[model samples]
Target chain A: MDALTDAELTILGLLVEHPRHGYELEHVIEERGVRNWTALGFSSIYYVLDKLAKRGLIEAIGPRTSAKSRVPFAATEAGREQCAAATREALAEPSPVRARVLVAMANSAALPDDEVAAGLAERRAALRG
Target chain B: MDALTDAELTILGLLVEHPRHGYELEHVIEERGVRNWTALGFSSIYYVLDKLAKRGLIEAIGPRTSAKSRVPFAATEAGREQCAAATREALAEPSPVRARVLVAMANSAALPDDEVAAGLAERRAALRG
Candidate 1:
């Protein structure tokens, strides 16, 4: 199987910790600022959960306590294995950092020096935020 | 118009320097170690050039000097303007660095502490290379 995407690894890793309903997953993701790191969206929580369920990497466990409470999902053995392997890969392999500014700087001859300097100033200000 | 992709930006940046055919552009990319930074592929050079030509950001200039000499492409006025704007945007914007390791660390509870430590050790060695 292919390596899990950041989103998949994240969701599976969370499920491996403990069974959680979709709402709980969303809450955890928000509390942890997961969105700031990965492109996982609020709407994608259920979608990702469904995908994991269909893949048999995760499965729903236990009955919902109430009609409003969604069924909780837990990682399967396969899911745990996959998540661990992915985590190991993530830890071992550093993804390339593509700095767009590097590319721009390389071709800065495309613009005047003053303009490039101004852009750098703007970038410094943006980064301060 | 949408911002240029990394491939688009890299190729256009090179073309903005001087008109070059596919072969020259390929040579420059290799000499500059551009692939180490961007996802631009050896084969995708022609494809990106074609896209730039179609968008009117770049255009064919002059005839092939020989059967071996490929048609060269150069950035047009519109192309220069766009490249400059994109360069400015690139310089002024700092894309978020999404470190997958951070996510893995956050959910490191998925694995044993020793395993996590081992993975990090492996990562350190990998980064040293």
Candidate 2:
């Protein structure tokens, strides 16, 4: 169903990999620079964890000082299933043509046909590469 | 700033084509099948129009009985500039990798190496094609 918002699915999906505390999740997000493409916020980590916990998609384990100074969260069976489904949805879904492209397409007259074709060719090449 | 959310940008970008009333916007949305990739709704059109107009990003033209009962809206100069900026942001901004792929990437061990390789190869082939 892709019921999870991009942030929620991202957090839960991360937990599916391993049990992680809030700080660990935050650390991984920063280390990977996931925030550049997605709007995952540092402050929203616990909020998502708590939300998932309430829905029984995730469970919080007791404090693990070894990793970080916070309780760790793990995906339950249902959570793993949810993660798989959501992940499939994410990957299978089309990467959207953003509005700027839509505007360009709508008013393509302003651009010479060759330039537009060239731009599209470059985009295709990048996707292929 | 891409301050416009996907819906807001979609709507404003539509107005960039021509002045359109509420029903026309709804009609265009349905005709385009945009709901597949984006979470646009029939109910949100006027709300978006009103919001854009309130921000002076759009101005309402006089009522046009021919199109529909609702008043038509047009983008103002500020609105056009905003559209251009926002549209640029939307296009330049990366279309994100959804959580599902991230999860699969993170937990690559569960899937057989060959399966992963095949999947990646298939994806690459699709992109190349």
Candidate 3:
């Protein structure tokens, strides 16, 4: 099987912390500022949950009592193992150059000087706050 | 529209470096050790290319001569702007917390001590070479 995408790992980590339904997971992601660049959808969350479950890494528990029907999920032994393995790999090496920012950095010189400067300025402002 | 996924950016960056056909692009990705954990398929590349074209970030040129028919791609002005924006954002910040290693570090204690140690040791070995 393919290694879990960063998005999948993020969902797994959140689930490991606590069993949450799709909406709750989505809420936590946004609240934590994890969706700045990639806006993870509820569908993607459920998709990862299903994939994790299929891999024996996670299992669905009883549904949560909420305004909408929600299925909570819990990590299984395999899920914990996968999460651990993923963590180790992620830390041990330079992360996969899959990050858009890193890819962009590789060719930043191709961009206009003014645009690059403005973008950096905006980023600094965002980070400073 | 939502920010392009990292995969989309990677595809764009690759095209910016040189206009390549789908197979050629895929070959470059694998040759570059960019597909260690994530196996990027030909379909995904084409998908991203289409999306980029829709956003005016990329333009598809005439097909290339090869064993199988292939559509070559080139970066448009908007694509350059997007790449520049992405680069600036990536360098100016601490980077997204989306890296699985960071997330795993956040909860590394949950993993078996021996497993963690072994993983780190393996990582150190990999880095030393």
Off by over 4 Å in 2: A19-23, A35-56, A59-74, A88-129, B15-26, B33-80, B88-129
Q: Give the best candidate by TM-score.
A: 3
State the DockQ of every prediction. Answer: 0.35, 0.18, 0.36
* lDDT string, candidate 1, B1-129, tens digits: 556877799999998898998889989999988866675666778879988999999988867474333888899999988899899888888875456777778778877889888989998998899
Tell me the tens digit of each residue's lDDT in model 3 across B1-129.
667666777777788777877788888888976654333555677767778889988887874453332778888877877776676666565554344456556556667788677777776788787
Give the TM-score, chain B only, in order for the candidates: 0.74, 0.67, 0.66
What's the C-alpha lDDT at position B45 in model 2?
81
Report each candidate's C-alpha RMSD, comma-separated, in the order given.
7.4, 7.5, 5.0
Give the range where candidate 2 chain A is weakest over 10 consecutive residues by summed lDDT. A92-101
Worst 10 residues of 3 chain A by lDDT: A95-104
Docking class of 3: acceptable
Ranking by lDDT: 1, 3, 2
**Tens-digit lDDT string for candidate 2 (A1-129):** 327766677788788888988988999988977764455656668778888988899997875454433888899999988776555544544344323345444434434567557666655666677
Evaluate candidate 1 and give its CAPRI docking class based on DockQ.
acceptable
Per-residue lDDT over B10-128 for candidate 2, one digit per residue giving the tens place of the 0 to 100 score: 78777877888888888888897765445555666877887897788888897545443377888787877776655544443434533334544554544456756766666566667
